[model samples]
Target: MNAHTKGKARSTRVKEGMTVKVVRGQHKGKQAKVSEVNTKKSTVYLEGIEATRRDGQKAPIPIHTSNLFVEAQK
Candidate 1:
């Protein structure tokens, strides 16, 4: 399959509290700060970044680190 077809992925060594940008998925183009780290699942919670319903409530979701590109602060 092509890169587009593949969804979020997980990589190693990323810690919590790092700033990151969405490189893929529905949340693409959004910037967020890391909130939590899950080594076993290889996922991280980005503050203010998540799927939402029509009411704007956050959906239960966690994007993989590989799907996130670390961003440098100004």
Candidate 2:
């Protein structure tokens, strides 16, 4: 088994599909649904939250789980 699943459960506070509020950064105070979770990196992708590229394309932004607070679960 890999390091992640080997010994103990991770202390991740957020999970996929959970509603979370941004506590910091440019998107602070915005509430969004958790679209994905990266336990290894401690980051989450919120639905409808993205950064616009120079070419006008939007890409999912990964926010550290610490920067978000769980609002509700879906």
Q: Residue 70 lDDT in model 1?
A: 78
Location of the lowest summed lDDT over 10 successive residues in candidate 2: 3-12
TM-score of each: 0.66, 0.78
Find the candidate with the highest lDDT and give its number.
2
CA error at residue 20 for candidate 1, angstroms: 0.3
lDDT of 1 by residue, 6-35 (tens): 874534366777778898998898888788
Write the residue-wise lDDT of candidate 2 on 1-74 in tens digits: 87687886544478788889999998999999999889999899999999999999999999998899877866
lDDT of each: 0.77, 0.88
TM-score of 2: 0.78
